[model samples]
Target chain A: MKPLYVIKIGGNVIDNSENLYHFLKDFTALDGYKILVHGGGKIATQISEQLGIEAKLVDGRRITDIETLRVVTMVYAGLINKNIVAQLQRFGTNAIGLTGADGNFIKAVKRPVKTIDYGFVGDLNNSSVNANNISNLMEAGFTPVFCALTHDGDGQMLNTNADTIASALAVALAKHYDTTLIYCFEKKGVLKDINDEDSLIREINPLRYEELKKEHIIHSGMLPKLDNAFTAIACGVKAVVIGKSDELGKLGNNEPFGTRLSKSNIS
Target chain B: MKPLYVIKIGGNVIDNSENLYHFLKDFTALDGYKILVHGGGKIATQISEQLGIEAKLVDGRRITDIETLRVVTMVYAGLINKNIVAQLQRFGTNAIGLTGADGNFIKAVKRPVKTIDYGFVGDLNNSSVNANNISNLMEAGFTPVFCALTHDGDGQMLNTNADTIASALAVALAKHYDTTLIYCFEKKGVLKDINDEDSLIREINPLRYEELKKEHIIHSGMLPKLDNAFTAIACGVKAVVIGKSDELGKLGNNEPFGTRLSKSNIS
Candidate 1:
């Protein structure tokens, strides 16, 4: 199978223009089939504030009301996504920016109203992604750039998590390619000590992952990401990397830049 | 050659939800290859007002300052474009929303300043449309839904006229397909009498169009549209149609819906 990379970038890279420029340059220079998944940054929140839509939160999780969704749809899918596509094109990458609604690439269901109504938020499952259509697009020579938005397969657009989208895409596309999912954030990797960047755990397999969890060395903030990485590895993705966005260039040269997780240590 | 429809709809169809829904359903019901170009409606202006970005006009024409450009990008490319794609997807159209930046499908030079600088507006020429790439996307089975936005090759998004985009696409794609360009607006067609709907000019060849102009029958508001339609006809578009959006379904059944323009009356 041909190698493919599914990379996700959060606010740390997107919020800063200089970082985004360097990140995109590295991204375009990397060889092979790749897809970019981007999360909404401070701009969405700032725009929401300007539009006079108060931020709603339940149990520390942000809510997506109708007005808030519109603002995000404009910022994420419209402003940020198109600008990124334009920049990629300037760098000679044939990029196509998309929301899940476009091409029906990912159809997510609205979260059910239980203890709280998430208000236009979408929750995905294994079958939520249209891998065949996405693969067809990549095979046609256009790189796909996805924003953190999905549709209900009805006429409604829903706010979604960018990280989850990246993992789902990797798992789905793994059937056709040697897929590696990379989550680029502010950290160097999963550090053994939270404050020490040099204490980066080079690699973790299922056994070592169990030990790390038992010892509670990973912080709460990193637990969900690690758990998701393991889930993706279990679903056939070749590897999952957690690292800093600035070090993307290192991957092309096979230098150690981040923590890599796979099914087994020997592999 | 295969038949392709390049359709443009303005504020009349987009500003109203009910009208938009019906129009999209009609659009999806039409057979053969089709592309939709949409204009930025009143919502952009509304959002601009809400954002406290004052609208600037020079010589009665709107100026696209940097702030205005951002708002329109959000509204057109992000909000309206994505919603239309989602709706079309719900109708099983397999639509992909796009701006000129996506796939480098269209590249425009920022309008040269002469009398007034239209800050971020884009102007297109014959070579602006990437015909082969667009054809490839269409041949790949994804219908394109474009908003009135284009990008300079250097990575700036620009405001563009949707009607011109539609005509440009029709002219460029004509080399590969038998293309018909349709403009859906508030009127039924180019009326012989401005106040009378019964005075529809069903067909207007070049000679008759010249006569209509000499006789002062065509109003100033209709002149630019007619000039563009004729230019498209001269450029080898199979035909151009001016009609009401609600009457779109009639075209699928070979029923007359709009005034048709062609090289000759017999065509």
Candidate 2:
């Protein structure tokens, strides 16, 4: 199977134009099939505030109300997604911006009203992804750029987590291709010391992950992300990388760009 | 060649929820390949007002300043486009919403500033439409739902006229498909008398069009639309239909739903 990269970029890179530009340049320079999953940046929140829509929270978790969903759909799927696609096009990448609703590529269920209604938030199930259609699109020479939005398959757009979208896509496409899921955030991978970049863990296999967790080195904030990464690996994704967005070019140079997570250290 | 419907819906249909829902259902029910081109609705203006972005007009013509461009990009390409795509998907049409930037599908040149600086407005030239790529996408079984947005190849998204985009697409795709361009608006069709619905001109050939202009039956507001329609007809589009969006279902029944323009009435 051909190697395919499923890269997810968070709001940190998207909020800064210079970082986005440099990251896109590096992304375009990489050869092979790739898919981009982008998170909603601060623009959505800013727009929501401007529109006088208050952020609803349920026990500290953000709630995606109708207004917030609309704003996110506009910012994530519209403004940022198209801008990235246009920039990629400028660099000779035939990029097509997408939401899960497009082509029914990802059909998600509205988060069930348990304890509290999540409003328009969608949670993915095993059958949510149409991997065959995505592979067909990539084979037809169109690189998909997805925003952090999915649909309920009943005429409603739903806000979804971008990291979950990336992992979902990576796991689904793993059957068709040797997939590597990369999560690009503010940090330079998982670190032994959160304050120190040089303390990057480099590589964390299942054994190392358990050891780190038992040692209390892996904190609560990074647990979910690591768990998600390991889950993807178990589901057939060849590897998962966590790193900073600006250092994307290092992947091409075969340099240790970030923390690589796999079943074992021996690849 | 396969028959294809290239339909353009103006703001009137889009602004009303009932009208848009019914129009989408009708659109989905139509047999054969179809593409939807939508105009920016009042929502853009509403959002612009909320964002405090003033409409910059020069000599009665709206100038698309960078601010206005951003708002429209958010509304048209993001909100309206995705909503339409999601709704269409619910109706079982695998609709993919798009701007010209996606897949480098439509490349436009920024409008040249002569008497007016249109800011980020894009003008479609002869080579603007990527017919082959569009045809390939359609053949792949995905319906293209377009918003009035294009890119200037150099990483800029330009505000484009939906009518122009529809006609340009029709003219270009005519080579690959038997294309019929439909413009859906508030009126029933081009009327002999503006006040009377009974005065609907059911058919207009070039000779009849000249007579209508000579008799002053076709008013200033309708001239550009008709000129565009006739130009498209001359450029190999099989026909052009102007009518109310709600009456779309009438077409399936072989009933006169709108004023049909062709080279001659005999067709």
Candidate 3:
């Protein structure tokens, strides 16, 4: 067995704590075999308002100012990151919260998009994941928790989206320990339709995904998730799945659940 | 006049919703800002214990196992981040939660500590911060809340502490918009005697701090906080102040708040 799994979660799963708790229980049961990454854009926006601080975005990417970045670090790293680690510990699993800012486990460059000022948003260009560090944690029987934030060579907290984060992280871990990628969110699977809950897309291919996206059948957010799935596959990840977080272990099996995404060249 | 303030919060002060609620109330009253950075560590350790996870740490660092990481991502970046942001929004603060993994804002390099495997922990090395993201957010009147977890180019979560995070972020923002670094925590101030609260070392210079440290008057954790504060000053940060979270804006006025650190070369 590869003994490693890469999981990415979105804001919806986070809002559902009971589901999250149960998911944690299940996750720990597979101890020393998984790395968890998450996103918190919606939450950060909410907190910014509370502080009477407005949130700024240029070209769809968050503009991380001083006060906003402060709330982000405090909420994501301090409160949220620790909360997940503590809950896992409570369930007899050792977990540590981390960001890309530490130990250079991951390296990113600033995204210089045309016309739009992405600002602190980082583009996935370089990474230097140390397997020794990950192996040591696994050897010590611990899990590493992560949020969607990165530090540039300059002293700034760059913004990254969950799908992009998941894809990048999956590539790192996949190459590190021959792992599979599981991207979890609100929907059990990616739906072909944006409005119809029953139109759950059973499976998808990179080409077919493009067609759906081009046709506007699937909305914008899911397109990024799908794109990430393909990126993971291209970067040598064993496989990629999009679904609800609680069903990872069960779905990641040979007869996996959720929406499976494969490279057109593969299947 | 840039209308920005970087408030760095500690995990100790925001362990619960009630504590955070009050903190948000006061934070909202302050002038409009663009960023907020937060920290949370103790709760993660606490919950890890409740779950029967061993919570392994070698040389003050936790191993990044899969299970632990998952719980951490869910709790910190996902759950806690959103919860706090949502609470702030409820308090009328428009806050958004962010993790380092989301944006490659804070990039790092792996610490090459000989013989010791600090799994997933990155050294504070990167300085390429896109203050434009923050500035844009500020201009848009949005608060960008950030957590410490960042994604490498390859997308792995690096373990980062909040102190350096605050300092680095402060430097980024201050340089971007010429702002202040407000570090808030439970401690009244940096103390010469851990046992004697009144022995608060009102202030200290780098040379004198080194002497006090050699005399064994400083704790290991405090060493890093002070070091980071100094780092910010050197990096062009206007000021750094430590105070309680509830009274974040009151520091530098009359309150006996937390310690303030500056560059030794300044004098």
Candidate 4:
């Protein structure tokens, strides 16, 4: 099977121009089919503040009210997504930016009113990802840059989590391609000591992941990310990586950098 | 050849919820391949006012500074375009929203500074449209909703005019389809008298168009729109119509609803 890289970049990378420039260069240099899933950064919050809209959060998850949804859609899909596509085009990568609604690439269900009413938020799973159309686009030689937004397949647009989207895409494309899902952020990898920059845990298996969690080495913030990584691995994604943005080229080459997640030990 | 309808809706229709809802319903009902091009309505101006971004208009044309370009990209591509696509999908139209930048379907050159420096404005002609990708997308069974924004083949996104985009798409697709370009606006048709809604000019051939202009019957804002219609007709489009938004279905059936621009007199 042909290899396809599905890379997800967080706010730390996208909010900084220098980091984005470096990461995009490495991304364009990586040969073969690739997809980029991007997260909304501080810009959305800043814009909301400017517009006098309040950002609500519950247990580290955003409550996407109508106004917040509008702000994120504009920032994520419009500003950041287009800017990235154009820059990739400049680098000779024929990139097309998309929200899940464009071409119905991804259909998600609006999060139901639970304990907290998360307005216009979407929850997606493997079935929600339109892998056929996306694979067709890759076959046609257009790299897709997806923003963190999805449609209910009826008429509503919903704000979604980028980490979950990356995992969903990776799992969906795993059948057609040997998929590698990489989560690029500010950290080098899952660190043994949070305060120590050089303490990188290179490779992790399902067993090690639990051990680390029980030891309290993997804290609250990295919990969701690690869960997504493990989920992608279990769903048949060949590999998953959580690493620093600057090390993307190394990840592309299958070199040892960042924390690599596997179902078991890759022995 | 299969027929293709290329419709351009101005700000008046988009700014009003009822008008847009009505127009979308009628548009989805139209048979055959179709493309919808929409202009940024007063919403952009409204947001600009709130953001304290000064909108500069010279000779009734917007002077797109960097900030204005950002606003239009957010509103047209992000908010309006996505909303329209999702709504159309609700009506079972299988709609896919696009900016010219999306698939690189349309490439425009930034307007060169002469007497006035129209900061990030784009100028597009026939060759600027990428009809091949569009035809392939239509063949894949998706109706395209285009917003008035384009990119330089390089890295810059430019603000483009929706009317010109509709004409360019019509002219480009004319080679593949029997194209009918419709410009739907607030008025019923090109009226012989501006005040008299009943004074509709039924059919307008090139000869009559010239005569009407020479006799001072056609004046003001309609002149540029007429120019685009004539240009489309000359470039091999089968027909062109300028009429009211609610009359979209009537125009599609060749019912002689609007000021139809044709090569010769259809008597």
RMSD of each: 1.1, 1.4, 16.4, 2.2
lDDT of 1 by residue, A146-222 (tens): 99999999989999999999999999999999999999999888899988989999898888888888999875888
TM-score of 2: 0.97
Chain A only: list TM-scores of all candidates: 0.98, 0.98, 0.83, 0.94
Order of the predicted models by TM-score, top scorer first:
1, 2, 4, 3
**Which candidate order results from sorting by lDDT in descending order?**
1, 2, 4, 3
Whole-structure CA lDDT of model 1: 0.94
Clash pairs, candidate 2, are none
State the iRMSD of every prediction, in order shown.
Answer: 0.6, 0.7, 15.1, 1.6
Candidate scoring better on TM-score of 1 and 3: 1
Candidate 4 similarity to native, TM-score: 0.94
Q: What is the lDDT, from 0 to 100, of the residue A88 in candidate 1?
A: 93
Over A1-54, each residue of candidate 2 has an lDDT whose tens digit, in order, gives 999999999889999999999999999998889999999889888888888889
Worst 10 residues of 1 chain A by lDDT: A258-267
Residues A70-170 of candidate 3 have per-residue lDDT tens digits of: 66665666556655665665565545566655433444677776787656676666353545545554544446677776655443455566567666766
Q: Report clash pairs, candidate 1.
A: none
Superposed Cα deviation of residue A161, candidate 1 (Å): 0.5
- Candidate 2 chain A has its poorest 10 consecutive residues by lDDT at A258-267
Measured with C-alpha atoms, the lDDT of residue A99 in candidate 4 is: 88
**Best prediction by DockQ:** 1
DockQ of 4: 0.60
DockQ of 3: 0.04
- Candidate 4: residue B209 lDDT (0-100): 91
